[model samples]
Target: MSVKRPNPAQWLWYAVGGKLPDRYREWVLHDATAPTWLVRHVIRRLVFMAPILAALYLVLAVMMNFDLTIVLVGLGLGVYAGMYYSLIFSTHSVDSRVTRHGYPDQYASQVRKALKQAERDRYNATWRNGGATSR
Candidate 1:
C-alpha cells in the first residue's frame, strides 16, 4: 500500500519512536530502498533526541542556579558523550526496532545499508537535477 506523504509535523513524530503513520510496514520500515530512507531515519532520530537533551540541560541548569556558561559546557559534553555512546550501541537499537516491527533480526544491517545507498543516490540525483530535490 502506498503511504500518504508525511508532513513535516509527522516527520517530527517519526523521530520520536512513533511508527511511520502511513505506509510504515511496506515502505518506510520494510522496503529500505527508498531514496531518503537513511537520511530520513537519521533526521528523525536527531529530532527525537533534541528535546530530551534540552530538557536534561534545563534541569541541570536549574539545579546549578542558572549558570548559563556551565550549562552550555555540560550540554556540549553531554551531546558528545551521547553521540559516542549511541554509535557504539546503535546496532542493538536498530536490530531491536527491526525485530519489533516483525522483520528478522539478522536483516537489520542489510536494511540500513540499503537505506544509506538509496539516500546517497537520491542526494546525487538532486545535484544532477539542477539542485532541485524532488520531494
Candidate 2:
C-alpha cells in the first residue's frame, strides 16, 4: 500500500491541517515560534474548510432545494463552530506533539509567547515604517 503525495498546489491544502506530515508538524511546533505562526495556523484551517462550506451550500440550497438564506445562515454557523474547535484543538495538538518530541509541556506556552512577541514586534516595525508592510 502506498499513500499518494500531494503535488505543489495541493501542499497548501495539507498545510491547512489535512493530516500534516510528521516532519512538517515537528518543524512547525519546534521552529516556527512566532505570533504570525498562530495567525497562519488559523488561516490554514479556515481556508482548508472553505471549499467544504461551499459544497455544503451547493448541496443544501441547489440540489436539496433548501432556502438560500437558510443555507447561508447554516454555513455561517458552521464556520463559527469550526473556528471555535480549530483554535482549541490545533493548539492542543501542537502542545502534545512538542511534548511527545521530548520538550516539556511548559515549552508550548513559551512557543506561544514567542510567537505573540514576534507578531507585536512586526506590527510595531510596520507602524514605524509609515504603516506600510509588505507580506
Q: Give all candidate RMSDs, comma-separated.
A: 7.9, 8.4
lDDT of 1 by residue, 33-113 (tens): 354545545565567678987887768777657788878887788777866776666666656655665677746677668
lDDT of 2 by residue, 1-135 (tens): 333444556557455544445545445454335446567667767787888998998899999999889899989999899988878786665565456546678577787787778888898877966587668
Colliding pairs, model 1? none
Specify the poorest-scoring 10-residue window by lDDT in model 2: 26-35
List the candidate 1 regions with Cα displacement exceeding 4 Å. 1-5, 30-42, 60-64, 111-135
Q: Which consecutive 10 residues in model 1 have the weakest lDDT in total?
A: 26-35
- Model 1 TM-score (2 dp): 0.58
Cα deviation of 84, candidate 2, in Å: 1.1
What's the CA error at residue 108 for candidate 1, in Å?
A: 3.0
